[model samples]
Target: MTRESLCRLDEKPCDVELRRRRQDWRRGAEAAYRYRQREEHLDVPYEHVETVGAFPLGRWLSDQRRAYRAGTMTGERAAELEKLGIVWDTADHGFEQNLAAARAYYDLHGTLAAPRHATALDLAVGQWLTNVRRPGGLGKDPGRAQRRAAALAAIDPDWNPRERGWTVDWQRHHTYLAQLLAEGARLTAVVPGVTWHGEDVGRWLATQRRDWGRLSAEQQRRLGELGVRKAPRARRTAAKTAAASGPRTGGAAFQKGLKALQQYIAREGGLPGRAVVERLPDGTEHRTGIWIANQKARRDKLDQAQLQALADLGIEWA
Candidate 1:
């Protein structure tokens, strides 16, 4: 959790009781994470460690650390706890400061605050411009937008919205939200701390559905630049663009191997806890890996084919 989280969302005064309560939650989270690692040691799996802190396992690790302290919570619960902990502990305390910076930037530049969902900095500007009728209005609040953008980027810098991963999709959506705000979209009470970015953009755009053709060159330019005309959606457009430019080799290869491994595991009733990928004839691939849960047994049979395949995937499975 972030140090800012040491208090609350509003940067309110966090009393000693609040700190204790927060740390209590922190301890349980840490214990649960320790259960995942087969490593059997603690640099702390991160979930357990509070932000900006050596948290030192605190009361959670004071005694028996062998069991999962938090219980088998849903993936979503676990994830929320992890992110909350990270932001509260590890994140810098410049949130309000940055928000102030962004507000100042917005007042003068005619630039709207870019949403947290923005991908490229330039594209984010374009996304902002697409919503604004005023030419370069986004530039007016460039600093506030920049700060919000940076905040969102910290939420998820490299995550792609079109694909799935272990992380939540909040940051990805936030960027497009800034775009919506620039477009003059009206917003309602956000869900507690939730930031509605992409959907907000869509709603703002809906208000102007009658004036698509009447849009100025700037709007048209942003629409065309963001590829929203044909794609009609920001996330899809970004994915199409990223796919056009992304390295197909590793990503494609990982998917192919991952699929085969999963299928093999399912067929075997469950994975042996390991997998590897190998190139085959006919441009297809083969997976020659073990899924042994037993560590020593798994290592004893680890062979050249598995080793080489793991190397090709830029991973080591020893």
Candidate 2:
């Protein structure tokens, strides 16, 4: 064979190999495109495999990322991936995804004080926020962490409850109350059994008032903004108030029933029978079973403290 023909044969093999690699890359790109179409994102998990072609798209993308970072990826290939919304830094991508979830939650609830089990946009946003609120949770880089914190603060200024000298639960309750007030709900109108986002908002509000002295200055200030003040001190003594209010006073009756229920539970080591009656120490006859039933029936009329009293006594419905 002529020398020129031999060189041409070698060139042909190299061209064929190049063509094969290009075809493989195109197939992976197709799979990636499909995934983006379905999920509207290219933030595929490391273990994810595209189902349609059973393609290891995630690994392929990882390879591309490594190549890009190593400065080996061709400009054409990088441009193609970028067009598909590829994010090279998986960690940053993950953070963005979680941020999106946080935004969604804030939009719905008006705050980021989500419970540990809360989910938004199919993401465990509550847990994510909890983690991110921890010291150094954003990342080791100070600038990055600051930026992330700013992003969260944009959603709700009190996104980190601990930083504000309170627990997430307390922040959640406060947020709920603020939301109600903004919606034109009066403080008195938010009584026991009033709930918002599964939280006993009325009960929480009552607790804040009752324990007003126990709260920090900052907490009190926040409550004050919502017009929630310390519960009023009675001018009359308990005995006089009870006597003046009469024996049929709702609070007094509830207390009597609670006392009787407690005594029964202590003696019986369980809930009282629905039909059982018990006499109080003062010889006041209380149909304890019927009273319990009535309490459950009138749960909405009960205040936070009253509900808590029942709950402490093992009343599940409370």
Candidate 3:
């Protein structure tokens, strides 16, 4: 999240400029709140916006902003925002006011930024109060905080962090889409011209992944942005290829017995179990002795094949 700093009059953000920008503060604030409601970064669609002949004039623009610090707000509100993917990144986004930084903070967590932007809204609110000094010019809070608050409240009120979270969800939605495309690519690579669509892509992306959600939003966003067109299919094929390339694997007394026999050949001129050894074609190596040991265990001693495996590794012999 960006670090937010509030500029004073004629300073970094120029309080006058900040106040000028606050003309549309309600809209911007509402957009931030609305953005919190969405699981993805999508601007408010035109359909959702209700245009009054003009936005209702209100005093929300004048409230003096109390210095914001952590822990003042918590529990339901904090958790709710968290669900909306509102991670208050302690790292600064470098805005010159509390409100601007707040917006940047929300944006870092994946909430959408509104088209109505205020460069230094927080300082502007303070400046507005400064411009409209009453009995004394510019008291702490200028106009009315509630009007802006109301506008914000009016935005996507349905956003419930308990019910839905944006960061993980956005990552999931896009990654699933991307992986599907990647898998398609893989399939096409192995078999040319393989076609795919939403459903097929979904299944393909879902099929192989065991725990992709464990990845962070940045990772998720990266992969999704990369897309899933052909990568998944290629991933599967790559896995298969890797498995094929890996050392041949099996568990058995057979292996142990083979190893023992090879060692026997190394050390002994003759086999202790000649009956087992003699059956081998002259050129045949310890492989025949292993089979012989296994059969003896199965038939004569009625032992399981366990010892044969041990013997195969040359760890032991019949």
Q: Please identify model 2 stretches exceeding 4 Å from their true place.
A: 1-57, 234-318
Clashes of each: 39, 0, 42
Best by lDDT: 2
Write model 1 residue lDDT over 57-143, tens digit each, in one string.
444433222223445344564465444332222123333433344344344332333344432322343243233323432235677
Using Cα atoms with residue i matched to residue i, what is each candidate's TM-score against the true structure?
Answer: 0.17, 0.63, 0.18
Pitting candidate 1 against candidate 3, the one with the higher lDDT is 1
> Candidate 2 has which clashing residue pairs, if any?
none
Across 126-189, the per-residue lDDT of candidate 2 in tens digits comes to: 9999999888999999998999999999888899999978899999999998987676554555
Which is superior by lDDT, 2 or 3? 2
RMSD of each: 26.9, 10.6, 24.5
Q: Judged by TM-score relative to the true structure, which candidate is superior, 1 or 2?
A: 2
Please report the TM-score between candidate 1 and the true structure.
Answer: 0.17
State the TM-score for model 3. 0.18
Ranking by TM-score: 2, 3, 1
Give the alpha-carbon lDDT of every model: 0.41, 0.85, 0.37
- Model 2 — TM-score against the truth? 0.63
lDDT of candidate 3?
Answer: 0.37
Candidate 1 minimal-lDDT segment of 10 residues: 186-195
Question: Comparing 2 and 3 by TM-score, which wins?
Answer: 2
The segments of candidate 3 whose C-alpha lies over 4 angstroms from its true place after superposition are 1-19, 40-85, 90-317
